[model samples]
Target chain A: MGKKTFIILAFQISLFNFFVTAQSLPEVKAHQKLMVEEEEKEEYEFARESKNEVEMVFSGLFLGYKKFISSQDGNTCVFTPSCSEYALMSIKKHGIILGTANAFDRLTRCNGLSPEKYRKDPESTLMIDKLE
Target chain B: MNIVKEKLSVFFILIFSLLGATKGHTQDLHQTFAFANELIESEQYERALLTFHRVLFFGKGSYQEEIFHQMGTCYYELQDFENAARYYDLAYFAEKNDSIKIELTFKKTSSLLLNKDYGYAQIELFNLPDNLNPYFSQKRNFYEGITYFGLGNFTESEKKFLRALPSGNAEEKEEIKQIFKNLEKVEKISPKKARILSMFIPGLGQVYAGDWRNGLNSFLLNAGFAVLAVQTAFQYSIWDVAISILPWYQRYHMGGYMGAERIAYEKIEREKGLIYSEILEVISETKTD
Candidate 1:
């Protein structure tokens, strides 16, 4: 009710407000810190290892096979036409003879010798022959 | 009475404002923490690491130790072993409780090993208390052996491996023994012999080491190239020789020779792996029966 009492009340209110503000500042800062820390933790846990064992084995096998095939001696030849050139030679040997018949029927419906024409056709056979 | 009412009204207003400010601060903190948690859970390690560093250095006081440990975890995940070791060391220093300290120490040692800082890793292992768990001891010894092996201290490596050998189960014992044999072979393989045999027969070194397929392939490849080179030379065309005798021919010839030795080395490794797998399979079958 007095002027002195009123002044003291205002001062006390100001001090309480300052203290509350200061306390909350730290809590807010701390919360931000915690969020960042958690993100880092997640990253660490999920890193990938370099190479798996199965992948390594497959790589080695493929490389070895490639090296072997590339180094084949030119002189050595397979009996039933060179395996590398099988389709070409087979087409030259059989294509004209089989060309008279229905193309799909002669190729797919017929048994061994007739189907061999389509099988050895250079355009289709070249790639498959080398793979084998 | 009117004056008193006005003063009370002001006081209530101040109280409400203070409460609202505090609540807002708390909510902001909660949101930040949640965001960091989401990043960590999502496995964005590098970003999470930066976030953690921000928290550890500039965040609230209560979570300092936890933040440091999490930073170490991030480094470990990223395969930054040196940094991981450093962070783990700090974490351990901050909190010396037995469980936390032991775990941190193990992590530090593992990071050091991964970094190929074997000397320091060994020192850390030596300092581990006798009361440390046996499983930890086994792992420590295994890592120590790997470090020694990497450093070319095969004698020390063998000793460490012997110490780590498990005696509890027949299968485990056999597996360890097989590893021991591989280590012995690795030690016995003389670089001189490898070089000499490689010089004499191109791929003879690999064949001597039991890599038949590789040795044969190497020998055939080199011989093939050599024949091509000679034929190209006899043909007396500069372009022919250049194409077949030089460049790719030389590279492939040298490669074939090196391949022979590499094949030999790989053959030894493959054999060891096969034997180990066989032992493991036997153990698993025995256990099942």
Candidate 2:
């Protein structure tokens, strides 16, 4: 082969390799972009779902109790049966019913009027009547 | 060979870019976690709760236990004892060290106590080592006595009181003495006499017990209830009769009598307590002087 033809052949091969590499660049870039986007979406979703879980858990604690007490001192009792019942209902609705067991024990054991002397003096039942 | 080297350079650049992006992502996560911790330390609970949730459910494996424990503390401070108890239970279960476990258990027990779950509180107290702390032991026994009294297990209550008495300080000793004296007087008061005095007037028995203040208060309270009962009965409101008449009047009148007897016994005990305290104070002052 002549020197000029050989040189031309070498240039043609180099040009071919350049196009091939350049052609794959966009595809690689697209793939990387897609993966990054997916990672971001997943992270966002994880954060959103986690926030909802926390809110649901918190709401379960405040259910049935007013946000503010009308009393002058701003002290509100949340362990009353009505408030506790609401909390339990919220917990059940949120599929977090496991939190209600302790709450129930608290209401009945701590807040309810003692039933021991109720039979002896039925009139004393008014102790808890204020709730009604 | 030169063309191959050029291609290799581009490949290396791509790998380095990916590594940089990953490094940035991790740094962002760390920053977010740090910010959450700062909020917690500053006691911005509501805001901290949001950040902690981010760390707990979204952040990687760093500081998860600490975040959860902080969340429980937030709930406790908010007076949401139920939620506090739940989170403390979670923290207790997740804790690796014995000291953390014990501390979490104490917090859980405190939440239960605040929520008024005396039964479960008792359960938790019993589960703790007897030598957890002398102060805790004394408080545990005292609360146990209170729970027994609330449950009307007088014998058991007295037993607990006696157990706690020996460990008590001067103030506690006086308190225990008063409780013992009251128990004795309650035992001595005749149920028949209480019923009789109660029938005579709304709160005459209380007056006999030297609890004139309580007697007067009971008298007025019962008289008010009696008036309301009479009005409701005449109004032909059977519901009112059922509630206001049978229960309110009868119970208050009877309770007045019982209250008087109880107060009489309580007064005697209180006087003894006062005397005991006075004697102790005298001894203490003399020693200090």
Task: Name the candidate that leads on lDDT.
Answer: 1
Tell me how far the alpha carbon of residue B88 in candidate 1 is from the true structure, in angstroms, after superposition: 1.3
- Quote the TM-score that chain A achieves in each candidate: 0.22, 0.27
TM-score of chain B of 1: 0.64
* Native contacts recovered by model 1: 0.01
DockQ of each: 0.02, 0.01
TM-score of 2: 0.42
Return the interface RMSD of the candidates, in order shown, one decimal each: 23.0, 35.9
Task: Write model 1 residue lDDT over B1-289, tens digit each, in one string.
Answer: 9999999999999999999998887776556555666777898888888776665554566466777788788888897889999999889888858877877877787778667687887787777787645455555565565556546565676666555544334555466566567756654665457647866676677677766776687677767777877887777776887865677555655565555555555655555434433432332332110
TM-score for every candidate vs. truth? 0.50, 0.42
